[model samples]
Target: MNMQVWASLFGVVLGGLLSYLAQFTTVRVAGRNEERRQAAQRAEARRAERLELLREFVTIAQEGIRVAEERDQAPDWAAAGTPEWFAAGRSVIDRLWVAERMIQILFPPRLYRLARTYASAVDHVLWRLPDQIAAEGSMWHHLRDPQHEFLEAARTELGAHP
Candidate 1:
């Protein structure tokens, strides 16, 4: 081949290789950036989901406390000792248990256990109280301290009065 023709072919081949390398590097960098962006988006979505679950858990807890308050306030003749009253009271306890279970589904066991102590206490009271109180009268005083502590803990943990 002529020297000029050989030099021309070398230049074309070298230019093609350089162009291919540039394109490859550009694609790799773009792919990495896109992957990082997608990872960040997924993390944000998971955080939002966690917050929603916490809100639901807090709401359920508040409802239980409210039912307890209502039950405590009812008059002896105003449906205090009836089966419906117990059912209403029991429902509040039931809801708390459900919330605890839901939390287990939504979060790690360690976090759920943090709230479980209070939940278990409330649950025990609800289940074991009816027969005990029926014989011994309402142990209303027993509820006061635990309720206060639970409310405080809940507020501190959830950043709300729930």
Candidate 2:
């Protein structure tokens, strides 16, 4: 080939190679960005699931507290232990047990420990005699401190607070 033709051929090949490389690089970078975005979305979804689980646990535990208080108020609760009272109390405890197990499985060690502490406080209220509960006043009073600690830990873990 003549010098002009050879030069033209070289330039065409060089330009084509560079264009192919640029397109390949762009596709690779785009693929990586897409992967990162998908990972972030999955992490956020897991966080949302954790939040829902914690909320459910708190609700069940609070119900337990309410049932305990109601039992304390009943005149025949401690003495006769009516079938209705036992049934209500048993229902709360059963649900609380399930929630506690879930917390144990899904939460980190610190949160699980705090949750157990709070559950213990609830148990104290439930098992206490009427006179003992009366001595302390409201059932909420018994649960307030432990519940506060548990919620604080949960909020911190959930990144709800800075």
Leading candidate by lDDT? 2
TM-score of model 2 vs. true structure: 0.85
Models, CA RMSD each: 5.0, 2.2
18-125 in candidate 1: lDDT tens per residue?
999999999999999999999999987977776776666667666665565555555653465477767877777777777777777766666677557667655544
Q: Pick the candidate with the highest TM-score.
A: 2
List lDDT for all candidates, in order. Answer: 0.66, 0.85
Which residue runs of candidate 2 sit more than 4 Å off their true CA positions?
131-138
Native-referenced Cα lDDT, model 1: 0.66
Candidate 2 lDDT, 1-162, residue by residue in tens: 699998999999999999999999999999999999999999999898889989898998988887786777777765646777678778888888788778888889999998998988887787787678668888778788889999999999999897
Task: Score residue 39 of candidate 1 by CA lDDT.
Answer: 100
TM-score of each: 0.68, 0.85
